[model samples]
Target chain A: MAWTNILTDLLKVNYPIIQAPMLGVSTPEMAAAVSNEGGLGSLPVGGLSPDATKQLIRTTKSLTNKPFAVNLFAHNIPSYSEDDLEPMRKLLLQLAAKRGYDLNAADLSNFKLYNYLDQIDILIEEKIPVVSFTFGCLDPDSIEALKRNACTLIGTATCVEEALYLQQQDIDIIAVQGIEAGGHRGTFIEDMPLPQIGLFSLLPQIKKAVRIPCVAAGGINSARTMKAAVELGADGVQIGTAFIGTEESQAIPSYKTRLNNAKDTDTALTKAFSGRWARGIRNEMMNEIEQAGIPIPPYPLQNSLTAQFRKLAQQNNDIEYTTLWAGQSAVRTTLTQSKDIIRNLIEGYEAL
Target chain B: MAWTNILTDLLKVNYPIIQAPMLGVSTPEMAAAVSNEGGLGSLPVGGLSPDATKQLIRTTKSLTNKPFAVNLFAHNIPSYSEDDLEPMRKLLLQLAAKRGYDLNAADLSNFKLYNYLDQIDILIEEKIPVVSFTFGCLDPDSIEALKRNACTLIGTATCVEEALYLQQQDIDIIAVQGIEAGGHRGTFIEDMPLPQIGLFSLLPQIKKAVRIPCVAAGGINSARTMKAAVELGADGVQIGTAFIGTEESQAIPSYKTRLNNAKDTDTALTKAFSGRWARGIRNEMMNEIEQAGIPIPPYPLQNSLTAQFRKLAQQNNDIEYTTLWAGQSAVRTTLTQSKDIIRNLIEGYEAL
Candidate 1:
């Protein structure tokens, strides 16, 4: 049978690859460039305001008018009391001091990161063709609304149990996230274990358990792996680290430099950047945090508290402090234009 | 060129696939079955006495006269002062007491492991065809001696830097082990940060860095993955956990049951078993060990201390108290005859 899905046919353009919706790093220009190259480009609105999300989507549309996916965080918001924040703030200050930074509680008190409820509305209003949710499934009402808007809804799952749950929720597609996926794990229902499942084992089991169209993610940076994913029963592949260095990405030059120099063995998951665990280049800050033996508060608060440190770290070009999100294949990532990357990927896939 | 080598041609194996020599679990019958089915079978002699090694090799020869390898530990013997043992013994007594066992300092003394020097002589006398070493390289003198004995020497490397070091030692083959490999890491020279590089990333880079033959290990257990490894430029593949359930192996019935029922998400690495890290089914012993926070001595010594507990745990059929070494593909393993396991592997390779 010929590959018939929208994603499969679309993949025919510049390889059956999709640039993952990497929040904070993916740019409108980057999305457009990938889409222009005939690959599915993704823009993550998880960290953006609704109005900002709409404006960004409009900007991307003006640039290419190509189909792209917008991603959201569907994880339930965990609660944190004021009492929890004070101790967490103290912990962060102590951690920074260990790294030779003088920071007091004032530096963290005004931190702000409200969830993007408006971004999901804009995706429906803008009639985006695809919407993907990570961490957990969205409320059934929101999923139904997005489906009514003609958006293909994709749910992210870290295990077969989660995928089956998503299937029962009636989502159109499932992103089978192997443990190697960079950034925060999409483990909503369950607290994922450390160094969770590898991709090879995770893919076939999830495929056997669920009937929905599957897209494999995590550490898939090469054309050979992309083809292998399809052969192993994935309809398409979603890649994040591969696009971190594309010319159109908003990632800083320093970030690109770190990625370029990364060895295949360089990446690891650390909770230092945000309180939630995410994979990144091991850095001085992570080493200090690991040794600190202090408990971090819940997600957004911890994400917000460390936000200034990360920004300052990025601006100073001090790689030791930055959150360099990447997979095990970081060393293979090339610094080039997105169009060239897509072209090479297409060539690699066809050669296979 | 068609795949042709001593390992490939001798077994009439189209591809070089060798089941790793797991000392405690890998049996002579297991190695023989793999050899009979056209793949290299290996017996890990790290934990066996020289005489035991001879008997194992003899048993294997009786079953299948095909080519096989013997694996050894090449690390220096762990040293501890007389004072060190008293503190270590006292700590263990407290742990045993918590587990409802009464133990004294006298209970901690007698532990002996097979001497590698003695085993090497036995293998040399028997004219074994292949020998592999982990944790470090065999001495240059030993490598030269083995070569004179017509034995192919394989060295394990955990990093590209280590791989380069091995190439200089003039070994005939190199097994590139990533962090995902089960059992003690093969890092011989220096303790490097865990690379966490999956087979996809490690295989190609090692292929580029070293001119010697390369065998890919760690988390590779599927037919599709085996094909991918060859395509990734590996000359051979070494698998361990995937063969755990075969009838000829020495894994306990309960351990095999746990492995067969394991999920892709089940296995995890913790230094609780031996001072060295290993991946296996997480059990009560692991949870208690992590919580107790008792410092473990460096390996071989720590490995020696745990032997009594491990033995008792296994004899009592209490899986919770034992160390069950398995890789991520434990879920896909089956309780079949060893010969059938090798037969299915050959069929899988041929089908691919």
Candidate 2:
């Protein structure tokens, strides 16, 4: 009678809803409240050190005894050649001089990735109940280690073929992502057309082809749509954009306000921020980047090159440069307490 | 714990999801099936005779014992001067002769529109349980007559001010339709912006200001999204494009095929057909219409003038000239059976 699935039972939530692991947007309080309200809440590992990731998990655990998830970006961090950083630095200086800022150089020491392997080790040692992945799959060693610790593993798949591949690896669940999903595309396989499937069309096809339980992700954010996904054979749903306006999220106040004012037609996927396709509000940065016509470097290097610009822009409330990742349902986000948001989600289910 | 509201209890349904009343696409069989599944089903009264309207209601009643709705066009039907029809007639004659179908002059009489008020008499005589109006509101006499018959009167509103006006007119429910809705724009009092407010931003504001229960319409198709609507404050939802894909629909095979194959960006609202804005798949007719640069006549007359072209195109399986009205959520509709679709919607509610 409660949500009929292993996920709902395992998570002890009323329904098989999962708040998305949105880095720079999700917070420990939000995650904990969602978990407490009987839906799996997730903390993102992107842009975090191992210590920070563990601290977030511990803080979330302190807030609620319910099961929660930790999401990891399993892809290898790209190494930036000095050749790449020098030009990016020169461009920044030139732009800054025009803006009347003193061009004082900062120390360029102690820069390194979070050491994903070390983070995985800590998660496994701590016996985290659920570990979901995006960007790429875990190595065989890591997958086996997580399994050995009796952890539920989920892999994000943008296509049916990818879902089948994940099933072959004996993963517990598959998050069937659609083209409308926010953040970096999880397409690591061959270059597909990004065919733009919706939840109603994609869920059944994945359900028919795969043996594992399917979790519909991407643009789902409503009671009616969640019910529709379940009817289409999705065992659970992962929602991200619906929670952007929650009081507990780490999203900037300006970003949250903009999200509240967005329209369904306001969202678009651009490869401007982070050198990968992500859906967000179209802004000046996207227009400028597309006009520049420069070949964007791959992954972490492109991310690192613009890190300072992003920090300065976000601090200045300049929305253009910051990576404002949100899905098509972003405008549906309501300004409310995280607990109240979960309560309304439950009521939406009940109304349906 | 059933989905039984005061209105649903009065109407004898378990849920509040209403199949939006659509002209040309809606048929008797479709209306009955939705009513049988415990939701409101509406038939549009445009371009139908009094006898035809009564016959449609009788046929729907025979198919199911539950209540159903009938929608009426409240806008002025345009009258064509002899100058307008003469030029159009000559063009039609040229085309017919080219196609080797020499129609007698008498055949032209069949293209004229039946009066809207005459159709209303058939609806009142039938004592229909629900009545809806689009494009404008009816006079006080019409509202009084329907209310005396114990009909639930609903009005379509494009903005918050329009909704307030409908409330003042003593409407039972106000349909808060967004810009993405298919078919003609429902602006009654004033000409609104093209592609004005989207569903997510529009729903909350209307719900906040309007005292009457708001029924959310325009581009809703899934449980998760519907949940968001209800959570934001809609008491019910009315969907058009989703139900258009069902087996009971009167849509051509090619129309359904195109809808299933549509991308997120495939739809556009063009005034090439019906002289009113409607969303559909882009086709050669729309392109040619745009290029022709002829001043479009008013409604009903413009719709009447193009009748021959539409008929011929359909007979030839031509996608052009067909008023394939569908919302932005048309991409999500794939159900072939109404029963299965109703069940899926139920499950979507359960998951929420």
Candidate 3:
């Protein structure tokens, strides 16, 4: 039952387990620790600047020589004028005022949105071995550029149609994200509504439809779920929430505590925080914003608009105001080192 | 690999497979066919009257002597006056008019809403050996009465809290209904929103929490999913959508055709048809009712109002307006016999 497959060979990892690149929580130390433990660790640069991304990649390289993935947000950058973000700005201001937080107009202004194309040269220059992306597929030019550098591309998909699209783009691996997945949904199909296909249904369908190695992501925190994903035809598993509790993660103490205390039914999907559908522990911020029934601005704009407020809440350790992204099986998370988490997953899978 | 567990032994089946009692689709022949194939067949008596339930039980008995469970809707009966249902009636009428189907006042009136209590005596009189319930848990009196008659009780839960409640009520087996399940959600806990936990995250959590045997229900169609559920700690599996494709099922031709043609992402959850959350294929009726933004009446009331419209659509083989309830894995379904489905599942598990 020793795990070795196309995913392992392509990613150059001993085990097929992948530490999902969780923005805001994942760090260079966390990624390096997981990779050193024989699992594919991911560095999320979806929200970082090219310079910062280079620094993080250099730091991770300093920590481990093992192959690790660098993840980016491949969404189309929307052209938004200041006026377009006015209503959402007012809403967030109103919400922050209720929480006794002061926000000035300057706090939400001058937000720089990162484009996927801008990050390609940085990955190529850094010689990043594996590149993963979510939100949408990379353009043909970006794909060719990354392929020319010999980077293994992993595209995120929430449905079979998206998986097929990723394969059509000549992507090397497909990360099949189920509805139970935490953080932002990787749904890129514009004409259709957000796909909420569970892993039980999505994994097998994607595996049957696509030829590339499919990695199951979502609510996969334990050996049982990992084994179940493999039984359903997944070549590997991409775990996210479980690693948030690891010592190497950069999550706030309260966020880690909430993950430890969460029940299976404690989480819900809300676009209130980032203007993109994400699974997280239901709190006052999610409830109040959703209850207000106002149209949320799209991602990057809304994500930037609420940045100051989220920072203030994080500083105060106010769990209610800050985002607490988690999967349905986040109840399995425990406070430990990244190495122990990876070792336990391997040992547990072996025992099973 | 021969499936013999607490669930199989208690239900008197050779394989730990329970054909889910899909209300409109399950018939006496369908139930008996599954039971005869060494799987526990279920006769859904939730919507039928006491006399009709007795007759169905007798018919199933005539078809097979193998043990089969009788399913009931244990939700509390809502008190609704004619005036209370008037708004919903008018809304349905307006929607029906748009479809060129005249829903007259007489057609929507005089509907009888059956109570779970009324159906208990029929099971006792018929000497039914196994009983199951969904929507909510049965009252203590009903539980005691069924227990007095030596009936093994199976309760449905969509979350950990509901499963613990069923276990506390002394339920013999718990059907852990995941978000990918079709038909009405079995979530009974009030004061919270509907639980949409996927099977991958839900099964293992319920297995850890409950002392009683747990049966995984939702998105379990083929041998792979069945084996995955067992590996994830399910004592058995309760499949619903797969059986709709069976020849013995009472589902219409168009419904069966849709099931065969559906993809994994085809289904969605909508509360417009029944006032309670249920997953089904996206159709005109669901989209229109949801888009209209009118408040839906509670179950039985909304269910009654939509009955005439659903009937007309079914009669004309118009899949658009019909209630095509299905699971997320409906794409895995094939038009076959109940015996072949059960045999395939058993053989598939063995091969795995």
Candidate 4:
């Protein structure tokens, strides 16, 4: 397989590597560093306001003239009230106290979601070339507006069904997030029961089912795995955990150290941190929350409530308190430069 | 990677394919068929007595003079009385009656576990060429005894930790069973918390961590998957569900049909069927048992108790009443000959 495939041509990158759209961790500098290196770089403005998102786009644009992608959250609003969140809040407080950490009670009075419509408007206003959707599919009107401009629309899918659904909506690219991927599962039908399929099984099946370009995302943090993905039928490879270990990534020094120190057995999926099931390094806070077995609040809300605790943990360099988002192949993570990471992937695969 | 690797050289096989030892379904005919096709075939005499094991060896030998592997269960005996099993037995009976099936009460008095020591004696006396183990690791003396008799020893592992353990015990080969694999997990440390890494990530890491030949076994029934495994650094491949749908597979007609009809989400892990987590098509009996939240007896015992219901379900061709043990890739199963499956794997990988 050649490197100059549809994904590389469309993205105008020298290599078929896309920096994963990791919210909070993947900053403008990291995105630019990869984009400058001739690989598709991504900035996740999913958790930010429209104004903040526009500012991020400008920062990334200033850093590098090369093409870059910006991602937004399209998850459905899950139902929950004060009562539903009460038990989880109390349990978290108890855990924090037990661990000798200073934690404040959650204030849900200002718990409004990010306006994705406004986000779409900002992207169009900023003339962002590449836009991606995660958590769920974008509404048809949002897709149309993005398409009305010359934006390449990428949708995240966890299974073949989701890929088919994306094709029906005329998605330009499908980012296949295998079960081995770190962070949140990008399942559109949140409540529907579905099996977790790996990228190797998912890529070939999705390629057979859909005509669009597929970018495999999950446990693909190395050159060997990158080559395996392309050989197994992936158009390109999207990497996350590998970048987290890079010096250019905004991940805290301790966070980077913990990720590098992690064994293959250190991670598992848990819904305690964000209500939606996500793979992360098992920590005291998450483990305690899982043990409590309290009814969790929905996504975004659950994520907001724990933001303060995570921030505190980061400030104290306590990896045992915050969620360590890494993939099943976290052991493959190496601390180096972002551009060096991209160079290694291209060189490794090409050498093979 | 050539087929002339350590695995093929050690096992004296043409292709790097090993038909997984499936008890109750893998017959002498199936084993012979696979071996005759230039791949290593395996017979699971895990649940049988010493006399029965020898008889099966003779039958397989008579069918083909080619090399084949015989497998056994090495699980520790869990303490459980008849009273401990009452809840599951009653729950299954109620489920059976509700489903309008004629089911027999389990006779628990004849529940003497297969004396593995005696079975080992029979394998040595009968001059069995190859013996494999699952469920748990064998002791040092047992490994030494098998080695003393000039018998090749293969150990099953679900993770890198287990693979390292197998290497320490002087095992000949490590059958790395990924999480996507069907049948019971070959976890050695049942009490330890372990991550379920898929074969795509598992194979490459295990190959780096251990010098012994690693056989990739999990959800690898396709040419694409087989090629993916080899490309990912597996010395050989062990497949189970792909062979189950064949005419020679002793799986019932409906079981074969159900396997063919399985979708990506059709199967999941359930301790309900055998009181040990195994992936299978979820049925009424299994569902009811899972919902009952009852403590059940351990393996070999729980497996014995549910034998009558599974038999009755098979007799009636009622898929909802029986356990359909297949991998996540069961949807790819084809109703061909055993030799045809091996041919497809080699030809598919070779064609690539």
| DockQ by candidate, in order | 0.45, 0.05, 0.87, 0.57
Q: DockQ winner among the candidates? A: 3
Error of 1 at A203 (Å): 1.7
lDDT of 2: 0.72
Instruction: Give Cα-based local distance difference scores for all models.
Output: 0.75, 0.72, 0.89, 0.82
**lDDT, candidate 2, A208-283, per-residue tens:** 7788888888656667566556656778888887787788887777888888876544667776667666778877
The true-versus-predicted C-alpha distance at residue A98 of model 4, in Å, is 3.3
Native-referenced TM-scores of chain A, all candidate models: 0.92, 0.91, 0.97, 0.96
Q: Rank candidates, lDDT, best first.
A: 3, 4, 1, 2
Which pairs clash in model 1? B135-B188
Better of 1 and 4 by TM-score: 4
- Model 1 agreement with the true structure over A1-352: per-residue lDDT tens digits: 0235655553333444678998878889888888887788888888667777889899999988778888888755577777877766776677667666656677787665656465667788788988888867888888888888878878888777888999999888889887678888877765556436666667777888888778889867777777657655677888888888877777788888888888766777877777777888888877776777777766767777777677666677777876888876665454478778777777777777
In TM-score terms, which candidate is top?
3
DockQ of 2: 0.05
TM-score of 4: 0.97
In candidate 4, residue A243 scores what lDDT?
88
Which residue pairs in candidate 4 have backbone atoms (N, alpha carbon, C) closer than 3 angstroms, thus clashing? none
- Please provide, for model 3 over B1-352, each residue's C-alpha lDDT reduced to its tens digit, 9 standing for 90 to 100: 2477777778888988999998889999999999999999999988678889989999999999999999998887788778987877787888888888867988888988888889888888888889999989889998999899999999999999999999999899999998989988988887888889999999999999999999999989888898889888999999989889878988889989988899877888988888788899989999988887677888877887898999988888888988889998877455488888888888878887
Q: List CA RMSD, all candidates.
A: 2.9, 8.3, 1.4, 1.7
Judge candidate 1 at residue B173 and give its lDDT: 84
